[model samples]
Each structure stands twice: as C-alpha cells, then as structure tokens.
Target: MTETPQRPLRVLAAMSGGVDSAVAAARAAEAGHDVTGVHLALSANPQSFRTGARGCCTIEDSRDARRAADVIGIPFYVWDLADRFREDVVEDFIAEYEAGRTPNPCLRCNEKIKFAALLDKALALGFDAVCTGHYAKVVVGEDGNRELHRASDMAKDQSYVLGVLDEKQLAHALFPLGDTVTTKDEIRAEAERRGLAVARKPDSHDICFIADGDTQGFLAGRLGKAEGDIVDESGTRLGTHEGAYGFTIGQRKGLRIGTPAPDGKPRYVLDISPVTNTVTVGPAAALDVVGLTAIKPRWCGTAPTGPGTYTAQLRAHGGETEATAEPVDGELRVTFTEPVRGVAPGQAIVLYDGTRVVGSATIATTTRATAGAL
Candidate 1:
C-alpha cells in the first residue's frame, strides 16, 4: 500500500537550546515543512548562565537556541511568555505545596504554556502546527482522530507528561523525536553530524525555576517560616519543623525528628495538614494507598463512558500499575489492582491503555489500604 505524501506545513518549532529540540527543528525543515524556530522566554529575569544542567530559561540558553536555529538554516525568534509561565506554572506550584499537595510543574507547563498559549499564538500566526522535541508520539487514527502515544524509546518516553493535552491540542502538535528508537548518545551523534553545537550539552534536570534544586528552601522563601509540629501516627509530638509545606508524602529523609520510631524502623512522611500546620511521620506500610479520586480531567480524545481497565502512572518517571478507572460526576476515580505506596494529592494521575495515552487528572484524594487512614 502506498502512503499518501504529506503536504508541507507552516511549522513553528520550539527550540529549547538543547540538542533534542535543535535536531527536531532540523528534521522538520528537512521534511519540506516551512519551519520557523522559536525559544520561549519563560523566565522573567533570566539567569546569565545555567549551573550545569540543573535548570533552564537562562540568557545563555536563549543565545544557544539562536545559534542552533542558525545552523538549522531557519528563522528564529524568542517569545516572552515569562509572565504567563510565572502565573500558570510557578505560582500554581507554590500554591499546591501550600495546600499540602505534591504538584508536577512540568505537566502543568505542557498543558498551560506550550500547548495552550504557544499553540494558540501559532494558530493566530497562520502556523499549521507547533513542533517540539518531546519524546512522545501523536498518532492519527483511521477515523482522523489524533491520539497521543508513547515514543519508541521507552526509557525516554514522555507520554505521561503529555497526557494532559486534549484532542484539540494534539491536533496541532508535532513531535519529531518520537518515532525514533535511538538512545540519547545516538541523538547527540546525529546532532553533531548535523553541525549542531548542543550535541554535548547536558540535559536539563530537576525543577527549571528552582535553580539550586533546593525546593524546600525555595518554598520556605515564598511561603515564609511558620513553626509547625512534627507528630507520629499516634498524635505524639516527635519534633518541630519550620513549615509544613517543606515535606511531601513518602519522603524518608530530612525529617529532623528528635524521636525514633518505637519499632526502630525508618519513618516516612505520611501526611501534611496545612490547616493545622502539622507534618505527620509514620512507618512506610501506612503509606500504601488502594484507590484515588482525581479532578480536572483532560482527555486526548473521547472520554471514557464506563469503567475500564488501564495502567496508571503516578509520577513522571515512575512505573505504571494496573488500575480500573472511570469518570463519574466530572471526576476520575481509580482503583489500583494492588496497593501502591507514596501516593500524593495534587500530583497528576495519567492513565494509559497499552502505549496509547488515555487521559490525565490531578489527584485530589486517596484511599489508604490500612486502618490508620488519614
């Protein structure tokens, strides 16, 4: 069977000053698309340089992006969306933590900044699609519906983060790095072959806005210091903390608790109540959660009408577990086949059917497996 030839499109390629994005733009241009490279100025006061690859959105990164666009032989421009990014991603992150929830800012950025704001602006500018180097695929079905799927490289697969995209956003999305099953080294090699300079550039890690990767310090600065009590499951005061927002569920270290567990076992953060300004620590077994309730669901295609078997991913780099999920009363309720540990509210719960993305929602609450449930 002969495949239909793809018509050239007016593509807006998002260049992140990294090898992956540079090569993605190059490939899009090579495919006969009218590609224009763009870098989003997501920081209000961009740093002069990055501290290794620990963060991004620096002045140095913008310059690197310009150089990559020059090598790709495409028109390049930087769009200032720093205000939107601060409001949508950064502030939302702070607020989530203040409410005693663990939020994934990357997923929120993809949903709000890249796909929504960027795609909307691109469409207004007559661009047919917004292309990126994300390690995920946008598969078009026989009925002409676009479906988000995992990339060929499972190790670098990023479909979980892209699960928040709805059908409209997926329609105008292009992921040039998704179809290849190459390793990170191979991608760097390809970038070198193409004369792109970021081939050896270190991949960005940790939270981008948190330059030093000290999330506790960052939150403390923003939320201010409020002395709180650290207690065990039995309501016995173990120690004191500067703030309740400094800890997360399943956290095992930096507890600074003066007292040790009665059974001499390592304790983990079991609960955080901002209202009471209390941080609760207990055994790891008490962290097991059997079910969850999620809100603000976003689907890639049609919403599921009935309960269905799916694999749920609780974290960006975490493993998936078998679950039965259904959408009821504008909320997603999921029951895991087995108890899972360290489940947290405010984190996104992405559902997948095989390699295809089902949808995503912000986890609002969880049902604990043990009798000592909070």
Candidate 2:
C-alpha cells in the first residue's frame, strides 16, 4: 500500500502554553503540514507562577509550551517579543488613557504583535501561514478572497477582537480552533487524550503585561497624580478625583461624589476630558448615543460598496446593533438604528454583514439628538 503524501505547506503555530493552543498545534501537525511551534514571550519580567490566570506570558507558560511541543513531537522556539509588546501594546495603552481614550490592549496585541510582527517574520522565513488558537473563522469566498467570520460557538467567539486584521493578513492566517464546532471543554479533552500536561491549565483572563488585574492602579502608577474635577453635563462641579484618565465612559462607581443626583438615580460617566482634566457624570439617558464617527477603517475584504446597513458590534463583549455604515473619505459614519449606550472613544466598532466581518474602525466621536456629546 502506498502512503498518503503530505501537503507542501510550512506553518508556524503561535502557542500560548494553554490547552487550546496545544490542541491547535497538534491539529496542524495532524493535517500533514510541516508545523513549527512558536511561543511569544510578551512579558519583560515574567512571574514564576501565574496566579489565578492573571498573566499568560509567565515563565511557566513558556515551559508548558515546550513540553506540549515535545508531546506532539514538534520543534519549538520562544521568541522574545518583550520590547515590541512594550512599545506597541503597553505604551500605546498608557498613551491612550492619558489622551482620555479607552483602548483594548488585546486588540492592539493582535494588530501589532501576533498578526503584524509574527506574520511578517513567518513570511520572511518561508512559512506559508501563521496559525493560532483564536476562536474566529477565516473563510475563502467564491471570488477566492478571504473573509473573517465568527466562530461556531457564539459564547467563545473572538472575531470582534480580531477585527483589525486586514484581508492581506487574513490571507496567511490559520485558526484551528475556529474550524471546530466544539467547546473549550472538548478542546481540553482532546489535549488530555494526547497526554499533554497543559490540558488542565487555567486559561489566562487578564492582560498579559498586568501581573494584577487592577487596571486603575496599574495606570495610576504609570500616569502619576493629576488632580481633576468631577462635573455634571452642564459643567457643574459635583466632586473631585485623583485623575481624569482613570475614569472611562459608562463607569458608575468610585466617582467620589459627595451628593447624589436630584432624582437619586445612578449616574454614569459620560466623558473624560484630558485637556480640562474633568470627568463628566450624567444620567443613563445621556449615555445613549445615536451615531458615531469611526476612523482608520480596516476591512477583511473589500469594504461594502458605498453606504449600506451592517451589524455593528461596539465592543468586544457587547451585543450587535443594527447600523448604517457609510464610508466618508477614509473614515466611516455609523448611525445606529436604535440608540446605543457606552460608545466610548478608541474602542473598536466591528461591522458585519451577516456572519462575515465587513470591517472595523476606532470610534472617534459619538453623538445623539440635541447634539449630546461624548
């Protein structure tokens, strides 16, 4: 009997020392590709133990990745991306907060580190594609153009966070986990069946660079002390705060206000002005934004022709809203069919036509009837 021939494709699998990535790498090898496991060392100073899944890039994670590689009989290497992670992700996060914008570090990491940096290096080194454990599908359309779509499991779909990836990046990307119709528990069972030690490893939930999950404290230490006034929509001084950068839109707690609203209702953060160093709080109604302007549009394929309706997801974990997205010059103007709440600046608004990702952009401004500002 003649043996089946292997496909002539070299794949670089990004292993995060978790069951998902271990299973992904194993699946790649099972598909008869020349798979090489590469773990990204994103932390400059990794802790010895990863506490409660707070840090994903600890030294133990690297070791676990190596052991998984050994179990799968694949060569593995750790790429020290600490400098790039710091400059592109960590510093950018700090700067965005300083400018009073709420940025998603995970999206920045996917845009810069995983896709750009890793994909570029993989291509230069003669690899055909860069594979990962992301829960998002890359589908090739009838026109032979690649398009990103949500995973089969809606609960674990990560397509929103991966919206920044353009068509060119999607062309050379592979997501093993995305192809599966199974849950995370099933993936762990697969790892256990393969006798991988990381099969039962806890999934990391916090920012990789942040050892502790205290985002405010982390920012305070880096941003220092900048006293600011807590005010209402009409610029009435309501209280005082340590810094304006610490507050995010839609935040309700920790305002340090001495008095409550006239109606005694919960007041949400409406805006954070870095220049004036003011944090504005108002009723939940004020947070309802009807339309938004998004800049730096990135499309998975060619953007929708002219103006059209698309399902717009405002945040990573938010529900989809019906919106009409129109391309004006290079930016996009999205008018929501229903007023949405907590549309913050610097947050990504990913557009979708059905399940296929149309594009994404960073929200620059949000407006409503009576020209309510944010």
Candidate 3:
C-alpha cells in the first residue's frame, strides 16, 4: 500500500468552506496527523464576512467546514483576525492607491496572515505545520532545498498568486490539494461523491475581501474622491478624471472622457499622480513597457548574495520572462528580456529559475527595464 506524507504531529488546516480546503483537511486527517480546522476571521464583520467566505464561507460555509471537520473527526475553531486583516491586507491595499501605485492585498494577506500571523499562532498552539488549498507543488530538492513548482494541473496552478512565499514559509506550509486533486472541478466531484454538503458551492471571484470587484467604489468610499486631469504623452489635457487612485495601468474603460483618441484608437491609463490628482491617458501602445523597478524584494529561498540572472514573472499566471536581478537597498532592479506592457506599481514581480523561486518584489515603478544587461 502507498504511504501518505508524514504529517508533522499536528496541523492547522485553513478552512474557508471550499471543497478544496475541505478535501485538504480530510487528506491531512487521512494521512494520520492530529488536525484542527481553523477559519481565519479576516473580515471586520464575521456575520457578514463573504470575501473568503464567498467562495463558500457563508453561514452555510462555516457550517460546511464544521460539518467536514465532524466527518473527519477533528477539532475546529475560528480565529478572529479582523483587525490585523484590515491593517495588513485592507489598509495596505488602500495605501497603495493613495501613493498612486497598485497593490496585491491577496499576496500581502498570504504573507502577513496565512503564513506569518496564523503560522505563528499555530506554532504557539503546538501545531507542526499549516495547511491550505492552494494549487501549487512544494518539493524538497536533492540538496535539501525547498521550492514551489507549478501544479501538476496547469489550469489550476496558483504558483503565480503564491509567488510571494519564501522557502521558510513554504517549509511550514502544505498544499494538500496541489497534486492529489488536479482541479477544483475534480475536488468538488469528490466531495459530492463522499456525500459532503459543500459539493456544489460556486467559486469566488474578484478580490475576496472586497464585495464584488468594485475596487473604484470601495476606494472612493474610504479615501473620498479627488478631481484630476487626464493627459496624453505630449502633456495635452485630454480630459478630467475622478481621481488617480481609481485607475490602474492597462485599464481601457471607465475614463468617462468626452473625446476619443486622435488616431481613432482606444485610450488606456498610462500614469497616475496622487499629488496632482492627475491621471495620464494615451494610446494602448503607451502602456506597453519593457522594464520596471520593484520594492520590498523577497527571495523564495535565501536570496543570492549578489547580482544574478533569473526568470521573472510580472503578474500571477502571466508568462515568464528572462531578466537579470540585483538587490539595491530594499528594492530590486530587474531588466527584462523584452519590453513588457502594462507594468504597474503595487503589483508583485516574482523571480524564478527553473522550478525554484529566486526572489520577488512589489513593483513600485517601471521605466521599461529592458535596457539593462541580462
């Protein structure tokens, strides 16, 4: 008979009432580990919390998690981390906009909440590791190095979203659903076959913490609106906009501009200015970029001691590109192989080599990074 992964004594499975997490908890228990199901209360209002819950965390979701725990015969609890969630994830998201940059709150949440805060709590409670439903593979290499690889099921690969994780975090983490279950569709079918109640729950979309994908509305609700000028590359005042924070690089709609492009083309957001409340708009070609600057660099493993050539990804699930990376102060200067378009501040760029993650950073700025040597 085949053996299961040696469960490290006890595990804290992060349950969000989804079929993936439910199966993860079950797999952990089946592997012969002491497992406890914990739901992270990341929303300000648990009773109304539906971001993570929206995937399945409704009252029905909590009940489904509880029910799954019961079926798996494990202990379950809810951790109220709303304040930290707001500060670390939600507030950070807003601050990125205020600074005229985009931010990946979900990536930040994984860094701050899932791996850091919750992992610390689990260790304090004597748990050996934390488990989740992310679709990525973690492997201890021949040299005893840990690296995250794309899932066996490419369509469900979440390594892009999880690109921010370092070796230390991946070490104490378990993606029980990565290879065992190839797809969410497969997992849901398994749950139903097992007679689990959360079998047919709809998948969550948009930013889980935000209600729907009304990012502009949410930002306006919190930071209030400021009028700004929409300009072209020649510094021509094409139109006015609501605020700089309401737009992102590569956005092609919702400008509400009175006039169309001079070349009979569509306009795209090129730049944002919080100080002047000004947003720059131009032809779609203006948004195409070659290189970028990144901040808060993190190497998946221990970062190389000096400059190194590496593969980099600008966005989650985006294709990989060739680049040379060097750590400068807290930021990284990455020169890409080609001119990359839609390079935006606040999004994360994760570096990799083969299957191993090299480093990652929040893109604070991009001036077409293709000029530097690779």
Candidate 4:
C-alpha cells in the first residue's frame, strides 16, 4: 500500500454499495481521516432489486450503501449524477456501437464520471482526496510523482480499467484495498467483522445499465432495425442480419449464417461496416490482429517520448501481450510481438510497465496478421 499521510486528511469516499467499497470507506475512516460517504445515483429510475447482481445502481443498492455508512459511523449522501452518467456513459455506448465499434462503459465511467466529474466536484468542495474500492495502487514515486500500479492480488487487479487516469487524477486518488494480498473471501470476512451489511452482497457484473444482459436487444431498440447483408471477405453474401451494429469482431455464436466455409468450419464476425450497412464473416484465423492504432491516449504519469516495449491488455478481463508502442502524431501506435485475437475498435488498449500502468487509449483501427499466421 502507498504510505498514508501522517496527518489526517479530508476524504470523500465513493461508496458503490458493494462489500469492497464499504470496507474501503471503513478503512479510510479508521485511518483518522475525515471521511464522508457518497453513492452515485447513476440511473434516473433505479430498479427495486438487482437481478442476481447482473446490474447495479438499483434502489436496494442505495439502501445498502446507506446502511454501510451508518455501520461505519460516517456521514452519507446520495449524489444525483443521472444526467451526467447518461450523457457520458450510456449515450457514448450507443454511439460507439452505432459507429461499428465496441466500447467499454466501465472505462468511460472511471475516466469521465468517477475521476473527472466526481473528482472535480470533490475538489470544489475542498476535499483532499477521492477514495474508492478499485483494486489498484497509487504509489508516490521517488521523483515526488504518483504512479498507478496493479493490486497485490492479481486476480482482482483493476488497473486495466483505471489506466485512463492522468497524473493530476492520480495525485488525489486513494485505494485502500490494493495492497492486501488476500482472497476476496477474506475481504468479505473483514467486512462482516466490521459490521458492514454489504459483506454478503453479490458483486455486480456485466453492463449495469442493461439489466437483462441482452445487449443485442438494447441496441436494436435504440438503433432500430436496418437489415443488412452478412458477407464474406470476398464480398460474397453469406446471410442476412437485422442490424450490423449488433455484431462485434470475432463473435462466433450468433452469426446465424446458413452457409458454411469451404472447409466446413464455423465462421466468426470479422468486421462491421456501418457506412455500407454490412457485417463481414470469415474463419477465426482472420481475427488475428498484429498491430493497432489508438486515439486519445491518457498517461498515468509522464507520456512516453519514444517507442518502448510493454505488455498490452486489450480488454478488461483479458491477458496481457508483449508489444512495442510509441506515440505517433497524437495517437498511440502499437505492434504486438505476437498476433492477438479478437481486438476490436473503440475498445481500450492499456499499456503497462510490469505492474505499473503506463497509459491507455481507445483503439480506432487494427491491422490483421497475414493469413495462417496464427
């Protein structure tokens, strides 16, 4: 864990009504800091109860957060950020899909809502720092700079999603749970010992806004139906689909194509073209990506001046791959040492120097490896 200040500071804990956040807030308060708990009301109309933890921002979650704050003896309040969340996260998600790309809403929420909007508001209120339950560390470097690093428990490390944080944001962030090299079950036990009611609460999963976990249905409702052709690499029509936006790169299960490949192998979605209103399908080999160009890079500390070798994580729950990355123009250009599969546009590509996060960017394009390269 990063060394806590000897002097007690004012901390605004963002309690997300989970066991993790509740415990995090408790630890902050116990550290002699003046702590206040606040839960974000992300949805305008929150559901009564979550469907087995498939979603969050429900009415029950707010109540659970309030109870946890009470148990911790901290002042609690609800912040209505529904409008900001809808505009920044929900709308951005729809727009990305409509543009034939896949976006990670969790990253957007961390960047825009949690760190940007929430931190700005906290600073205006004279708060010293914003504390959360994210499983990532903020280490004060020898040069007096704050660096973002992965958690001790690699299984629960959330550094990939938090790569969007810049140097300014890192200076005012606190993560109390990052250094604990214990299993999640032990954390729950700690919460129980602390009398936090959320000790047994299930962790939220999937896209929170889409409660049913039916992403295709959600997109269909917003984008409506625009029937398009599902074609092959050679532009040969293999089948048809209701909407091209519904498919993502490397998706294999729902292609619904009646025609099989020449080798009778299952086909996967290779590309989506919104301009042509087409969804291209081919064998899985075509999904191998050798290089990618990403836009709007955000560095945790200092930006890299030249090309460097680092491990790149393409998705939130994905494994890292060795890559050489450099800043070119205003974008990040990365070439993987070995081809990686299922890399999609609009997704975040986070670079790390071992356990420390280097930066992150939104993937705009990908270069596929040669045929049979994989």
lDDT per residue for candidate 2 within 79-120, as digits (tens), equals 998899999999999999999999998999999999999999
- Candidate 1 lDDT, 1-374, residue by residue in tens: 11111578999999988888888899899999999999999987787224566324788778888999999899999999999999999999999999999999999999999999999999999999999989988887777788888888999999999999998888788888888798899999999999998999999877888877889989999999999999988899999999999999999999988777889999999999999999998998999999999999999899999999999999989999999999999999999999999789999999999988999999999999989767
- Please write out the lDDT profile of model 4 over residues 1-374, one tens digit for every residue: 34544568899999988888899899999999999999999988887224556325777778888999999999999999999999999999999999999999999999999999999999999999999999998887788788999998999999999999998998889999997786789999999999887888888877888877889989999999999999988889988999988999889998888777999998888889999899988888888899999999999999999999999999989999999999999999999999999899999999999999999999999999866422
| Candidate 3: worst-modelled 10 consecutive residues by lDDT | 1-10
Q: Is candidate 1 or candidate 3 better by TM-score?
A: 1
List candidate 4 segments past 4 Å from native: 1-6, 48-55, 371-374
How accurate locally, in lDDT, is each candidate?
0.90, 0.86, 0.77, 0.90
Backbone N/Cα/C clashes per model: 0, 0, 8, 0
Any residue pairs clashing in model 2, and if so which?
none
Q: What value of lDDT does candidate 1 attain over all alpha carbons?
A: 0.90
Off by over 4 Å in 3: 1-8, 51-53, 56-58, 369-374
Instruction: Please identify model 1 stretches exceeding 4 Å from their true place.
Output: 1-5, 48-50
Better of 3 and 4 by lDDT: 4
